[model samples]
Every structure is written in C-alpha cells, then in structure tokens.
Target: MFIAIFSIIIVLVVLGALFINLSPEFGGTISDSQKEQFSKSEHYKDGVFENLGGVTMSMGFGDYVKGLKGFFGPQINTRPKGAVPINALDALELANYKGPARMVWFGHSTFLYQSYGRNILIDPMLGPVPAPHPLLGGKRFSEELPIAIEQLPQIDFVVLSHDHYDHLDYGSILKLKDKVQMFFTPLGVGAHLVEWGVAEDRIKEMDWWGETSFEGFSIKCVPAQHFSGRGLSDRGKTLWSGWVIKNDGANVFFSGDSGYGGHFTEIGEKYGPFDFAMLECGQYNKLWHEIHMMPKETAQAGVDVKAKVIMPIHWGAFKLAMHPWTDPVIRVSDKAKELNLPIVTPKIGEFIYLAEPTSNGGVWWKNVD
Candidate 1:
C-alpha cells in the first residue's frame, strides 16, 4: 500500500511538471492589469478553489477533462473519403470591396473584415483543430481553407476575445504573429503570446474598456461574460472580452465569445447604431447557458447593439454542442425573423457586403450532412 501511494504521488508530480515546462512559455507572472480587472470584476468565477480566485472562470480543468473524454470517445460519422465538403463552392470573393465594409465568415467565430482601407482579423483560426491536443479534440468541416490567409490583404491588427482554444488557436497565432502588425487582447493573455515567441512590444493588454487606435480605426475591449486560460494552471488570471470597433466610415462590433447579458444594451446605447454586428449564434446548450447564449439571445443582442445588420457566428463548424449542428441556424433564423432583426446566414467563406446593409440571409447549411 505504501509503495502504491508513493508511485501515485510521483506520477502526479511528473504530469504537473510536464504541463508547465512543455507549454509555449513557462511561468508568466500575473500582470497588474489582470489583477485589477479580475480581482473585482463580476464575470470572474472561482471555479476550482476560493484562494486562487477568478483563476478558472471560463474553463476549469475539470471541464476540460470532461470535454477531452467526450471528444475522444465519439465518432459522429465514421466516413469514407471524396466527401464534396460543405461550402465547396467558390464561397470566396475579394469584391472591389470599395463599400464602407465587407465581412467574411471563416467558420465559427473566425471573421475577416475590410473597411475604410483597413484590414482586420478577428478571432481568426485557420487551423485543423481547435484544441491544444488534436488527439483529444474533434475536427472542423472542410479540411481546406476557402481562400488562403496569405491570399488576403495585409493585416493591420488582430483582436482576440479570449484564450479558449477555439477562439485563440495556437497554429493561427504562430502564423499570424509576424504577418500582422499588432495584437490586442485582454489582460494576462499577452503572457501566452510572449511565451509563444511573439514580441512584447507587438502585444497590447487591455482591461475592460482599454482602447487603441491605428491610422483610421479604434478598437475598444469591452466586457465579455467569459473566461480564459490555455493550460490548467492559469485560468482567469487573464481577462476575456468582445470588441467595439470604430472606424472612419462604420462602427463594427466583434463578439469574440459571450453569453447573453445586459451588457449588450449598455454597449449598444454607449457606442452602437453600428453598421453591422457579428454575434455568436451556436455551440450553446442549456448546461452552459450562462457562458453561451441561446439563438434568441443572439438576435436580441443585435437589436440592443442598435445594429442595422447582424451575422450569427460561433457555429457552422466544430460541434462543441450536440444539437444536430443545424439547430442553431434554424433557431436563430426563426428568432431573428420573429424579432424583426436583420440577419445574414452566409456559407463558410462567403464575403458579406454591408452597404448600409442588412442581409436577411440564405439557408446555406440546408442539406449539410
């Protein structure tokens, strides 16, 4: 019995060490900005322990352990090849894009926006998987990118809403770090990039309302009811947030990831009447309702933001929730129409032209297997 106990203790110690040393960077000192934001923020939740406070708000080790177990356990459609891949059509087009704004969906929360001669990428994940260990996570639809990242215009800024593997991908950042001019993230998240070989000067840490400006664009980090952490040890030591983007000709809101909250009304009234709002509309379940909004809430968010048009994201790829994959679209479409909200349900990789524009949308995912 004594020897068995000793071996168990030794195994745990070894695993813990590997988790730390094998990370992109090791031992990031908690930033003062992170401390101030989380130590007092209402969104912060002490999931694992009371003393550590706000360290595991969005993702707990326990939650991930459960997720990994499920991901590895199931095979949704053990299939044959030659699958004509959904969105296999020419879903991409670099329109003269001379209009005030153009938005493109890259599946899930990844989007590319061009407006007023500025190129911005939001939660851009052009990767195969959305997990630290692909061995433990599921795959995305359509293995190929509709259009390559390098094929696009030069990126001026990259904004991240959170550190969740789905929103902030390791492969995407590694490729984008040098190509893009700068990165803006909530506090403590800079530590992750710093660990991953990104320059500190290029990474800016923002508290809830921190703002930064480029030539013709201003980005403000707004409060998102979410949490952060790449590994087990450093969860809400960082902050997570959506963004309010103010440009010369258009105001755009990028919801990196959020659950429904009254903050939407506050954001709309404060800096809205936005030309377009891109909000989440999927990967939600009743079990995690507080962190992922239902489809109805998404349309409501559009109205609250005073947006002329709304695009539902955080779906159409990666079944983080088991709702037949098409449920979110159907539900959101119904809700948006019911609420008299203007919506665009584009296929993966389709560029949306927003010329004072609101698109009622096409049901592109209709026969998606």
Candidate 2:
C-alpha cells in the first residue's frame, strides 16, 4: 500500500514537471548574464525581485483556506449577464488619425496609443483567456476584439508592464512580434519575449526610474507595487512596473497593476500633473489588497499622480475577483466625484482623445444586466 501511494505521488510530480517544461506559456528562464545584471538593481536581492516595503501575499494557512473559499464560493454578478458592448475600430480612421494623440482601451489593461503617427500597444493581452489553458480561466467578457490582431495597424512599439499571463499573453505576442518595431519592458521581462521569438536586439529592458527616448517621445519605467510570474516557479523572477509616456504633445501615465503605494506621489512629483492617467481599479479583495488597490484607492491614486483626468482599468474584461463586474467603475466613479476629479469611463474600443478626454459614451454598463 505504501509503495502504491509513493508511485502515484512520483507520477504526479513527473507530470507537473513535464507540463511546465513543455509549455511555451511558462515563458523563458533567466540566464546567468541576466541574473548578474538584475543583481545591480536595489530591488533585486537574494536572487528575486522584491517590492518596496514588501507585500504579504498570504498571511498564513488560514488565509490560504479563506482564499480557496473565496475562489470556490458562490458569487453573484461577477460577470455581466449579457454580452459586453464593444465598438469596432475603424481601420482607416485609426491609420489616418492626426493631431493631439488618442488611445483606445481594448478592455482590461490593454490600450492602443497613437501619437505622431506611431502606434504603441500597452499590455496587449488580446487572447480569449488569461491563463495557460482556456479551461483554467474563462473567456473574456467580449467574444471578439475591436480589431483582430492580424488587422491591427503596423505597431511601432509594444510596451509590456510585466510577465503576468493576463498582461503578457503568449498567443498575442506570437501574432504581434512580426509587425512590431520595438518592445519595451521592465528588467528581466525581455527574457520571456526572447524565448517567445522576439528578436533580442528589438527588446529593451528598463529598470525603475530608467528613461529613454524614441523619436520624440520620452518613455520612463516607473515603480509599481506588484509581483510577476507566468508560471508557479518563477514568481518575482522578473520586475513589474508602470510607465510614464510623454511627448511634445501630451503626457500620460499608466499605473500597471499596482496597489496603493507612495510610488504614486513619487511619480507625480517626478513627472506629475499628467494630461491623462489610466489606473488599475479591479480584482481586489481584502486578502490581496496589498497587491491590487480597491476602487476608492484607485480614485485617490489619480489625485496622487496629479492627473488632469483619469480612467479606471484592469476591469471590464475578465473577472479575477469576487466583486460584481460593475462594482469597480461605480465605486471609482463615486470616489472621483467626491474628490472633484474628472474621470472618463470609455467603452471598449472607444477612442479617448487626449486634448478632450471625457466619457463620450455615458454609463453604458448600467444597461447591461
């Protein structure tokens, strides 16, 4: 009996190992040279990336059981009852777009920013699901993307916030790599892209506070209080970050999957008074509040960053937490109103012009069941 149980355990371990090794979705391993380079960053110590002040992902065994219960428990309104409304992108209009810069939210954290005729995609995870396999995480709220990956205009830059499956999809990268000119990521994240087929020369890995310029735009890799990993074994192996993108025309901030931290104030001080800001506002629970901000915190983050206008993201696409699907936008909007801050709630694929940032589509989610 003991021998049979031991054999079964061995077989299970072998299968798990094989699955991780054979799966391309797990992403690339860090090389010795990459590790050496990462060691120089203050955040990199003891061979793994550390968050500022450190985040407690799990308090203890009780917390783990609570998390499990939350995951498996019956939750209502976690997803929209009806199809999420999305607009089809006008390819000709996008290609010929001119003037004060514009962006389109592709649900969740994905956005297509066009400025001076250059197309930049941020966290372009356009796949159906945010997991290694479709069975693990369900499909996105919307069945079809505003524009198909093949139909996207030639991309000049692809800016990735981290190596998380939700933000950095393997299938999306496979389709985007050929058309993209350059890829920007936080430290050690390029290894994943390189492993996936992106040319090493085309990828630029930036440390926190690192700044660079391409054409007329100034791009800075800023700090975020978040963790990174595509597979179980590689947690914190790569860095995660928000971005400050600016040009002569407009300045923008993207709070890439962060919790409430002093970094927002720091970012604002260094590069604040942003023309627009897209902040994370969903997938938050009390247990994981240190990693993902609540909706109210999302509103305050906008004020901290000195943003002229803010839009709540990291929701509306996939249900990563137990909250109702509309809870994020509603709570954030209420908080924004209380703070006297302007907020834009654009529908998926709706264009948000920087010069005039407002919600052209009014409260569309209220109609959805």
Candidate 3:
C-alpha cells in the first residue's frame, strides 16, 4: 500500500514537471542581457523583482496546501446562468469616431482606450480562457466577445501590466502582433513579447517610476504590490506595475492587478486628480490578500488615487477565485457608495466616454443565476 501511494506521488510530480516545461503559456525566460537590465532597477534584488513594502511571493507551504484544497473544493455560481450580454460596437465606427477620451471594457482588466487621436489597448486579453490551455483554466464567463481580435482597428499601442497568462495572453499577443504598432511593458517583460514574435524595436520596457513619452501622452510606470512570474521557477524574473497615462487634456490611472498598498497614495500625490481610474476589484481571498485587493480596498484605492471616476475592473469575465461571480462588483458598488466615490459600471463593450461616463446602472448580472 505504501509503495503504491509513493509511486502515485512520483508519477504526479513528474507529470506536473513535464507539463510546466511543455506549456507555451509559461512564456519565455529572462535572458542574460535582460537579467543585467533588471538588476539595474531599484526594485530588483537578490536576482528577482521586488515589490514595494517588501512583499513576499508566497504565503508558505501550509497555506499553499490549503489553497490547493480550496481550489478543488466545491464552487457555486461561478458562471452566469445565461449568456453574458454583450453589445458589440461597430469597429469601423469606433475607429473613425473622433470623440472625447473613450474606453470599452471587454471585461477583466481588458480595455481599449482611445484619446488624443491615438488608440491604446491595455491588457488585451481576448482569449476565452486565462490559463495556457482551455482544459487547465476556467472558460470566460462570456464565451462570445463583442468583437473578435481580427475586427480591431489599427492599434497604436499595447500596454502590458505584467507577464501573467490572464493579462499577457500568448494567443492574444500572437493575433495582435501585426495590428499593434508599439508595446509598452515593465522591465524584463519584453523578453516574453520578443519570444512571441513582437519586434524588438516595437517593444519599450520600463522600470518602476520610469516615464516615457509617446505622441501627445506621457506614460509613467508606477509601483504596484504584486509578484510576477509565469512559472514556478521564474517568479520575480519580471517586474509588475500599474500605469499613469497623462496628457494636457486628461489623465488616466490604470491599476494593473495590485493589492492595496501605500503605492496608491504615493501615486495620487505624484499624479492626482486623474480624469478616470480603472482598478482591479476582484479575485481576492484572505490567503492571498497581499497580492489582490478586496472590493472595499479597491474603492479606497480610487480615492487614494484622487480619481474623478472609479470603475471596477478585473471582474465579470473569468472566475479566478472561489467567490460568487457577481460578488466583486456588488461589493465594490456598496463601498463606492459608502465612500461617495463616482463609479461607472458599464456593460461589456459599452463605450465609456471618459468626460461624461454614463451607464444605465442596470444590475445586468443580477438576474443571471
């Protein structure tokens, strides 16, 4: 009996190892030159990227075991009862519409922001599953998107927050390679893009607190409380960050998968009064609280960033956590009301005009069992 159990454990271990090595979703490793570049950043330490507040990557082995159990435990209401409603925008009309700074949230931290005559895509994760393979990950709540990747207009810029599969999808990047003119990512992340066939010249890698100029906009890589890695051994090989997009006309702050931390107030002090703030407000658990923020903390993050309007993102698409699918937005809505913060809850593919952001305030997901 003992031999049988031990042999089974060995087989499972070997299979897991093989899978990690074989999965293309694990992405590319940091080259020696990339390592040298990463070492130059203040955030890089002990041969890995470090978050502010000296955050540790893992909770511990015991907690990890608990997490694994929780992951396989029974989950309820993960997917909506019916097809998630989608309002497909006319791609051609959106491309030609010269209007105020507008954005269309494709759900779960994916959005296309157009303003100042440039089209920018932030975390264009159009893939149906967040994992490397559909068999390994939960399917997106809404199977059909408003528009397919081929339907997108000429993308001027692509902003990547990190190298996570959900945010930096290998499939999506491959499809977008020809359409996108430029890619901006944190330090060491360009390695993955380069591996995936993005031109080296088209990719701009920046460190935390680094700033770059593109067209009429000034893009700043800001700090976030999060760890980075696509695989077990490669944790912290790349940097993670939020972004601040500012121009003479308006400023936009995008919280790219960060936990609640002092960085919020710091960013607000440096770049306050943003026209809009898009923040992660989902996929949080007590065990991994250091990596992802709760809904109330997400609202406070908006206030800390001094945003004129706060929109809850990183929800409504994939079920990366055990919580009920609608728990995130519902909690955030209550928190925003408590804090008296202006919130914009737009339906998927609905264009959110930044200047006068309006949603029907419909609890569209409520009726979805």
Please report the candidate that would top TM-score against the real structure. Answer: 2
- Candidate that scores best on lDDT: 2
Q: Among all windows of ten consecutive residues in candidate 3, which has the lowest summed lDDT?
A: 360-369
**How well is each residue in 273-327 modelled by candidate 2, as lDDT tens digits?**
9999999999998888888999999999999999999999999999899989999
Which residue runs does candidate 3 get wrong by more than 4 Å? 1-19
Q: Lowest summed-lDDT stretch of 10 residues in model 2? A: 51-60
Q: List the residue pairs that clash in candidate 2.
A: none
Question: Comparing candidate 1 with candidate 3, which one achieves the higher lDDT?
Answer: 3
Q: After superposing candidate 2, which stretches have Cα over 4 Å from the reference?
A: 1-12
The sequence of per-residue lDDT tens digits that candidate 3 reaches over residues 1-369 is 999999999999999899889877777788887777677788888889888868864688998888898788887886677878888878888678766698899999999888856889999999999887788898888878889998888988899999998899999998999999999999988888888888899999998889999877899999989988888888888999999988766799999999899999999999888999999998888889989999999999999999999999999899898888899999999999999999998889988888887786378887676
- Candidate 1 lDDT by residue in tens digits, 286-350: 65666788999998999988988898898876767755677777888899999988888877766
TM-score for each candidate, following the candidate numbering: 0.82, 0.97, 0.94
Ranking by TM-score: 2, 3, 1
Q: What is the lDDT of candidate 2?
A: 0.93
Q: RMSD, model 1, all Cα superposed?
A: 4.9
